[model samples]
Target: KVALQFEEDWKERVYDRRYVALAHGELPKSQGTVSSYLKDDSHYVTHSSQEDNGGKFAVTHYKKLKSGNGYSLVELQLETGRKNQIRVHLQDLGCPVVGDLKYGDGSDPIGRLGLHAYKLCFKHPVTGEDLKFTSDIPKAFSAVVEAI
Candidate 1:
């Protein structure tokens, strides 16, 4: 599907990729493309070999404001819409989004995907009005403001 739409190899254009779960559960560690991830700077599937990696998921153009353990901001258009596409994809590669249940540290007390539908800069679906709006980032994404 990606090749048909983008008309490109797509793989070479992959600046980063991963697999993440968007549902709640513990996944087997022996899954996903871990080898490629270790050698490729542009890939991160998840943390460690075992951890949950899902919950409201979204794929954004991830932008890390700092090195590992700092702040991160991923901005991405909705690719394959799914309850957990972002989380699932990230988990597939192996860096589930933070705070995710099916795809993050099980310690996450937060019950939502850190992802948000912020900054919708487009015309109104009706009324033909030009508009741009942004959804307030959930307080939970606090880890973001200081870095991005």
Candidate 2:
């Protein structure tokens, strides 16, 4: 994992494209996107000496890509690397990642957690070199999104 930074600078970008299991209502088609700081919860805990005052902040940006009968494909950019940040944020959004047993309704539509990292960009700390890597969205992901 990349070095965790709590600042909101967003210098390190981790973009994920995932399928979410929607409930009774679907995401607003016209809204296009949503972003906010993730509220602190027990899921953010880590092996550290710092006290848990519930002030730790995490930001996530979401863009709806497609809507199916009971699911939606979304692109998410995490500004903070808190543990389970994406899952927790999506859970709070009311439509958790599909197949996420800990956060969602545990609907295993894809037979696994519907989260995938498609891109990662960060500056090397010591060399100050810009580093970036990207991968194709999984075929299973595309199959699910296309069904929308």
Candidate 3:
């Protein structure tokens, strides 16, 4: 027999999301934060410069883990989730994620988006205990990091 349980208000719980991205060019700093008001603009999201416009505030912190062969491995923590926040913010920093043609340099070395969600942390809904999950980086990502 098996049972499943969930918190009464689990949908409102907060979570931490971390991802690794292979980006083009070197980041300006080893680590930093990107904050912006993002709004949906058709196929993608864009920074909203106007205060009166409707947009969601997004923030992310990124660190350079490795760089070589015209590519840099960036580790990112999402403070606020907005559509395409990582891709847009990275592009704003002038280092788009490799293989992210819509929001990057348009190079598809691995034939897929160069972004991977490596970690997620949150409170367990039913038990109210801290829960953290991590996934191994895909071989493609590791290969790019090693190659560069």
lDDT for every model?
Answer: 0.40, 0.58, 0.81
Per-residue alpha-carbon lDDT of model 1 for 1-148, expressed as tens digits? Answer: 6336333433323233322223222233323222111111134433322232332233333333222233233443443234445554555544456666556555343466655666544333334355555665565555443434
For candidate 3, write residues 1-148 as lDDT tens digits: 1123345444345477799998888899999998888887775647544253578888889999988777788999988877799998899888899898678879877889999999987776657688889998778876776782
lDDT score, candidate 1: 0.40
Residue pairs clashing in model 2 are none
- In candidate 2, what are the lDDT values of residues 30-83, reduced to their tens digit? 233333344444664322212344445666667776666667777777555666
Clashes of each: 35, 0, 1
All-Cα superposition RMSD per candidate: 12.4, 6.6, 3.3
Q: What does candidate 2 score on TM?
A: 0.66
What is residue 32's positional error in candidate 2, in angstroms?
7.1
Model 2 C-alpha RMSD to native: 6.6
Q: Per lDDT, what order, best first?
A: 3, 2, 1
Off by over 4 Å in 3: 1-12, 43-45, 48-53
In terms of lDDT, which candidate is stronger, 1 or 2? 2
